[model samples]
Target: MKSKTVLITGGSSGIGKAIGIYLTTKGYNVYGTTRNIAKYPNFNDFKLVQMDVRNAQSIKDCIDEVLTNEVRLDVVINNAGVGITGPLEETPSEEIVNAFDTNFSGPLNVIKAVLPIMRKQQKGLIINITSIAGYMGLPYRGIYSATKGALEIITESLRMETKSFGINITCLAPGDFATNIASGRYHAPVIKNSPYEKVYGDTLKAIDKDVDNGGNPIQVAKKVHGIIEAKNPKIHYKVGTFFQKFSIILKRVLPDNWYEKLLMNYSSK
Candidate 1:
């Protein structure tokens, strides 16, 4: 296969960074974007640029920079996102908006910016890094699920619409990995005397523990490379452990009440 140019957002750390490095090793020219370059600077072996997916101008600027030298963008990984945990009632409006803006609209901005180029070139791949939470609503992480589920629907539509143009769009829904996502997660007011304190504390601790024991970030990167090389990749890729991916099927097959109970039990444990 010919060499390709790849652009990955939020590539400074975690899965994005891992994908960039893995792709570079395979001979693809890679440009990884991050808002904070100083902290990451360079991650092993990918070129770094400053780009915030939530900002249209920043997205345009980064794509323009990549196009300048690379001539064409062969792949785009929409990996920039944020995590928020709070009861829907207590989660601030601003926090909700920010979650949607960063996790959902951010990918839309990048996709819109790059679509023209890819359509003209007649071939490209767009991967939106979503999460398994998107498949179902988890209590405190409802907003996060909404954002990812929204992206999945959008990506499905895009795949159908862009089929003839050779633009391949896929959603990479990962379960959990030991990334810094937990450290920087958004929090709603879980102050003393709040009714949700005990539950919130318990759920958050459980979530973090699951992530700590989750698969390595590099595993996702390897799957990304497979998606890149496949002539006909699927519309969605699940990068997680056996049971986590299986839960998607379980959700569809199980009775509604049963599934809800499962989520209640699983998330709170």
Candidate 2:
């Protein structure tokens, strides 16, 4: 059997890199994309290509390069996203646009670029990396949550639309993971006299700590491998700790006000 070719966006580091390396070891041909290929002069775990997810042309060129070398594009992981944290009121409009462009539209661009190739093959899989935060409107992270939540909802519709074409689409929402996302995320500065200053400051610290103490990203990588091997994958899969996954369930069962209170209480911690 020919090895499956996998393309992962933002595959240079964090969960993306972990997934690429793990799949490579599992006998899959993995091609990871980075905005700047020059940064990873030593990235040999898999094929690294240049791509800016925000740029459709870049995505096309990267996919073209991959198709040039491989016969079939088996899997596409839309894992390229940026982290944005701040009170929606305080975050700059431009920054908010950037966040949405990178986290939301970026994945759409990659999907559009690959769907044609996948449709021609008559069998393909697309896994979207969402977030547990997306299940709710997280304090100081509302925009980030909205972006992922939108993708999650979009995945549902996309799955049905492409099912007839032998294409599979699913979302994998992971909780906080120990990664370098903090260094790259856009953070709205806490103002000296602003109303949300104190609480926002505290929440920022907590968010950072959560990432610092979060679970190993390799766990997510393992989950991705399982999803790939499954015969019929579900529309939604979550990779996170007990509490993180449970939080989503709580929202579904608890009263709206109660769930809001629960989130507030948890964020205060």
Candidate 3:
């Protein structure tokens, strides 16, 4: 009879914001965290916490505030991330570290902070927003894909570990949802001075074009709503346009050499 409480990271914009709005409208109490809550004044229905996932102290403070106020967390959505585009050889070490910290460790930190409360309650859901890139490698997205891939593995392990605790873990693997995530792509500062700059310059431009043509974020949010409301959420859910479904099938059915060529051909365009 009680309304469920959902906590989302990076909920100010894009997929996170869409999901927050949808779930809030559905009568779930929602809390969202962002580095700049002032920038997102439209989130009047949900509590906004100023927290940066890369900082341990900030995460602790944010979680503590939520626990103090809400007392119990019914769901935790790990959606905070960044995009890095460039050849691995041309990418700087700092950029790679930042990408991993935000996309991978950010979710781990949030889950760790929320698990105790969920354990106490004896029932909860953890949803990880990963990407189709998690399942397969892609050109110019080496670091980004690595982060999502790591998350997919972690989600699977957590699902198995938490089954007995009445906590559910689901990894939502969406393929190319239209979001500002594309605009957040960071070009390594070292690339400007690196010898392989020319090799990745054109590839980065192509990546931007691909993102611009990606599907809608609202659709992905709808999928998130369905997953959360379902009596039994699947281990992995993929949502996107027809192309995404096709890609998922290809990745599973096609041979490795053929899949590599297919991805390379798609990326080159």
Candidate 4:
């Protein structure tokens, strides 16, 4: 059997990289994308192609390049996204737009590019990497949460729409995992006298700490591989510590104000 081809966006580091390396070990043809191919001088895990998820043309070029050599694209993992944290009022509008573009629309772009090809072949798989935070709005990370939440909903719709074409789509919402996401995250400056300064500032530190102490990303990779091999994938999947995953269930069962209070108390901790 010919090896199945897989494409992952923002694959140079973090979860994307972990997924790429693991899939490669499984003998899948993996191509990871980075906006700047020159950045990784020593990357040899799989294959790194040039792509900026924000740009449609770049995504197309990357997909084209992959198909040019391999002739078949089987799986696409939309994993490229940015983290944005700040009080929603303080975050620049442009920055909010950028976050949406990268986190939500970026995945949509990849799906658009791959759908035609996948439909032509009459079979394909797309796994959208979302965040558990997206299940609810957090204190300082509202923008990031909104972005991921949007993608999560869209995934549900896309899955049903594309199922007839033999295209499978599912979203995986991960809780915090140890990666460099905190470093690349855009932080709106904490104005000295702003009303939310102390609270937002404190919450920001806790956010980074949560990511720093999170679980190994390879666990996410393993989940992805299992999804790939499944005969019928579910619409939603999440990988995280017991507490993190439980938080979603808590939100579902708790009353509105009660859940808000719970989140407030958790953020304050």
Model 4's alpha-carbon lDDT is 0.95
Off by over 4 Å in 4: none
Cα lDDT of model 3 overall? 0.85
Q: Model 3 Cα displacement at 83 (Å)?
A: 0.4
- Local distance difference test values of all predictions, in order: 0.90, 0.95, 0.85, 0.95
How do all models score by TM-score?
0.96, 0.99, 0.92, 0.99
Cα lDDT for residue 51, model 4?
97
Listed per candidate, the RMSD to the true structure in angstroms reads: 1.3, 0.6, 2.1, 0.6
The positional error of residue 252 in candidate 1, measured at the CA in angstroms, is: 1.0
Candidate 2 lDDT over 1-269, as tens digits, reads 99999999999999999999999999999999999999989989999999999998898899889989999999999999999999989999999999889888999999888888899999999999999999999999999999999999999999999999999999999999999999999999999999999999999999999999999999999999999999999999999999999999999999999999999999989
Query: What is the Cα-based lDDT of residue 209 in candidate 3?
Result: 75
Query: Can you tell me which runs of candidate 3 are displaced by over 4 Å?
Result: 38-45, 189-199
Model 1, 1-269: lDDT tens per residue? 56899999988887788889888998989999998777874355779998998899988988888888877899999999999999998899999999999999999999999999999999999999999999999989899999999999999999999989989999899999988888778978676878998898889888889878878898999999999999999998898988999999999899999999998988777
